[model samples]
Structure formats: C-alpha cells, structure tokens
Target: MTDVLLGIDQNVDRAVTQAETMLDLFDATDLDANLLHDFVDNPEGASVKQVDSVKRARDILEDAGAAVTLREGSGDPAQSILDMAEQLDVDLICIAGRKRSPAGKALFGSVSQSVILNAERPVLTCGSPGDEA
Candidate 1:
C-alpha cells in the first residue's frame, strides 16, 4: 500500500482538484490518504475535520474508495505539513500550487515551494485550475 499525505488549504476547488488528481493517478484500493489542514491563526481552536476544504477532500477520496485519515496542525502550514509527512512516513506528499507572481512569492513565501525543497521524500504538486505552465 502506498501512503500519501495530502495537504489541504482553504480553497475548496483546489482541494477537490487535488483529490481527483490523486484518484486518477493511483488505484483507490492501493492508496492510503492522510488529509491534513493547518489552522495558521486559530484562536478559536478550529479542527481540521471542521474545515470545509478538508472535509470536501476527505469526502472525495473516501468516496473513491481510498482509505482516508483526517489530521490537524497548528502554526506554520509548511512546517506542519512537513512534520506530519515525517510522522506519518508517507510515501508521497501532495499539495496544490497556487499561481503566484515571482514578486508575490518572494514577498509572501510559498508552502509548496518550501515542502518541495526541504522534503526528505517525494512531493507531488499540481497547479490550480487556470494556472499557466
């Protein structure tokens, strides 16, 4: 069985697209997906399961017959995702990449870029719908 750590953010469309991509790439029966959401500024202590994007991704993966596990993290999203990937020892880490200008990325940084550069394992990234190559 191949284990996958899928980082889910606030974009429901991206999350669904990522889920569909995973289903297309691998057989559901052979995949174990860990759906993760990070609450970067949650003074209210939000749960990952409570997030709409995470829930939608979980539903899509689960409906496709993939074994799904919900995970929550607090603080930096990139670090949280990386830590979770290590903790779970997943075969691959999947994340949706946003279309950002170089200046924008430089100013704000990118979680997907950080994960890709620093990960000890393979990372799969897909551009958001309408993103140019």
Candidate 2:
C-alpha cells in the first residue's frame, strides 16, 4: 500500500494543523505521522532536552486517528525528512510551508523549500495556518 508519511517538525500547533489538513489529502491512502523528536529536542546542539508541548502534540495527533511514528535524527530539518522518505520509500511527503516573500525567504530559507528542492519523491507542502487571512 502506498504510504503518505507526514514529516512532522517541532512547531506543535503547525504540526497539529498540518495533520488535520492532511486527513483530507490522504483519504484512501494509509497515512502515518512521523514526528521528528530529536529535531525538537536538539535543534542547535546535542544537549538532552525535553519539551512537554511536543509530547502533547504527538498525543493530539494520535487521538485524531493519525498513526504516529517517532524517530531520532541529527542534521538539517530537510535532510531528516528526506532520509525518512527514502528509507520508508514513501510515495509522498506532507510538510508545512510559510507564505514568505522571496526576499524574506532569501534571508532565511524555510524547511519546506529545502525539502521540495532535495526530495526524490513528490512533496506536498501545506501553507501555514496563520496565513489564511
């Protein structure tokens, strides 16, 4: 069965919104929420960290009927998501994207940009929830 792995990032609110939105995009297909824990725990450097909000987000997704998958990773966010995609042979990746201007993004490239650029398989990027104005 073709699996749609929703590559989750640290942003809890975003991840929850993404998962809820993805529920529509992946109706018949099997969907799994692969939450990137180490990324949340160690964004800048390797120091054991814990955040309750992230754990709560994972539980929220699970309660929403999302099959959750957790794993540790150390690298760029784009690389982490891509590695899982390749390893699982995922058909598509559902990620979050911000509606940033070219100049704004040039100053800081978002994870969505990196994933879309390097992913071997097709990527589906959902816009930020806050930008629905």
User: What lDDT tens digits, residue by residue, belong to model 2 across residues 18-127?
Assistant: 66666666653355766554363454564312444346546766676767666656667778888878888877887877678888888877778898999999898776
Error of 2 at 60 (Å): 3.8
After aligning candidate 1 to the native by TM-score, how far in Å is the CA of 66 from where it should be?
Answer: 0.7
Error of 2 at 104 (Å): 2.3
Clash counts for all predictions: 0, 0
User: What TM-score goes with each of the models?
Assistant: 0.95, 0.73
User: How does model 1 fare in lDDT?
Assistant: 0.91
C-alpha lDDT (0 to 100) for residue 101 of candidate 1:
90
The C-alpha local distance difference test score for the whole of candidate 2 amounts to 0.66
Tens-digit lDDT string for candidate 1 (2-99): 89999999988889988999999999999999999988899987778788988899999898899999998988999999999999999999999998
Local distance difference test values of all predictions, in order? 0.91, 0.66
Best candidate according to TM-score: 1
Report lDDT (Cα) of residue 38, candidate 1.
89
